[model samples]
Target: MHLYAGKKHQKYILNDCPNDQLLFAMGIRNGLTVSIVTKQPIGGPIIIRIKNREIAIDKALACHITAKAVT
Candidate 1:
């Protein structure tokens, strides 16, 4: 199954990101959370809501964002 937009996923703690994702990781540490806001049907950037900020990230980068399924 493919991941669609408007889905709420588990948070990937900022402390968990690798060295390369320093900036992305830092944001999370500052009370930031992310949610999939939108997705382009034609393999476009994935829009994510981080706190009050909405950032559009490419599919590849989006996948790298880790989130666990909540039961």
Candidate 2:
């Protein structure tokens, strides 16, 4: 699996990911340490984990937020 680290976080995007299968695949491929905080209060950071490692602030704060919002 390929990994990309962005400003705030690290992620691997599987294009055309089918349904919730994306999450499952990501978890397994990356060691199942992911979480989604969709309805948290504003300014509260959303936590996304991968392979027991935390992502960067920029990727987590920017890219991850954008992806989660859209999906």
Candidate 3:
């Protein structure tokens, strides 16, 4: 599903992502509240704000990260 911009939610990690080891080292673990900063066009990357840092991740990697909308 497409995540909306300016949305706030807690990331839901399904399994350990060995490919993104740096994410955990950077403190981007499960349950972390992430804000959808912005999204690129034509299935481009997505800029997510987490822990006060804004990181751009591609669509492929974005699929691995899931979250639920915060109320």
Candidate 4:
């Protein structure tokens, strides 16, 4: 499922993406715990928290990401 579709404060398990290097540099990886922090208005970046770090990713890149919600 798309990471952008995730709601704020909900935890999710991150999945692999085509852009491994980029995501890795930002400390994101498969099986990592992540959560949506905030989404900018007017088509801007979406802020997400991975571990204790929060990173902002664009919508275009977010669409390519796959995340499974954690109950």
Candidate 5:
């Protein structure tokens, strides 16, 4: 996952994403210029925009939740 911050005018390219479902779930829209790329088998990169400040995330404490509507 890659994080970017700007005046909501910045664009991001997400390479090798798992699926389009994740991107939609993250509240991303086409106008936002958020690109999500997924591999054929699954698993890839996801990029999202955050505020123009510092954010801290702990990978060890993170978890994944599957939605019935996403598959």
Candidate 6:
């Protein structure tokens, strides 16, 4: 499922990402635990948390990232 499908504050693990280098720079990678911090309104960026750092990424990019909920 896309990253956008995850609920805020719920942990997820990235399964696929189109831009590896870009997400790597932001500290996101396969197998890492992440969570949605906040999603901005109307075409704004989506805030995500990885390891203790929070990063904001545009919705377009976010839609390409696939994640699975962490049980």
lDDT of 6 by residue, 1-71 (tens): 99986789898898888866887787777787888999999988889988788899879988998999988
List ranges where model 3 is wrong by over 4 Å: 1-19
lDDT of 5: 0.29
lDDT digits (tens) for residues 9-58 of candidate 3:
43422233335876666666666667776778898887777668987777
lDDT of 2: 0.33
Task: Specify the highest-TM-score model's number.
Answer: 4
Candidate 1 overall Cα lDDT vs. reference?
0.50
Q: Pick out the ten consecutive residues of candidate 3 with the lowest summed lDDT.
A: 9-18
Q: After superposition, how far is residue 28 of candidate 1 from its true place, in Å?
A: 5.5
List the candidates' TM-scores in order: 0.55, 0.26, 0.64, 0.89, 0.25, 0.89
Query: lDDT per prediction?
Result: 0.50, 0.33, 0.60, 0.85, 0.29, 0.85
Look at candidate 1 and tell me the lDDT of residue 2: 20
User: Worst ten-residue run, lDDT, model 2?
Assistant: 62-71
Candidate 4 versus the native: TM-score? Answer: 0.89
How well does candidate 3 match the true structure in TM-score terms?
0.64
Task: Give the per-residue lDDT of model 5 (tens digit) for 1-71.
Answer: 33321112344442333334644565433323342222112232222333332222222211121111111
Alpha-carbon RMSD, each predicted model = 4.8, 11.2, 4.2, 1.2, 12.3, 1.2
- Winner by TM-score between candidate 6 and candidate 4: 4
Candidate 4 residue spans exceeding 4 A from truth: none
Cα displacement (angstroms), candidate 4, residue 47, comes to: 0.5
Model 6 deviation from the true structure expressed as Cα RMSD, one decimal place: 1.2
Please give, for residues 1-71, the per-residue lDDT of candidate 1 as tens digits.
12232364433222233234644554643234455667777888777666678666667655554553323
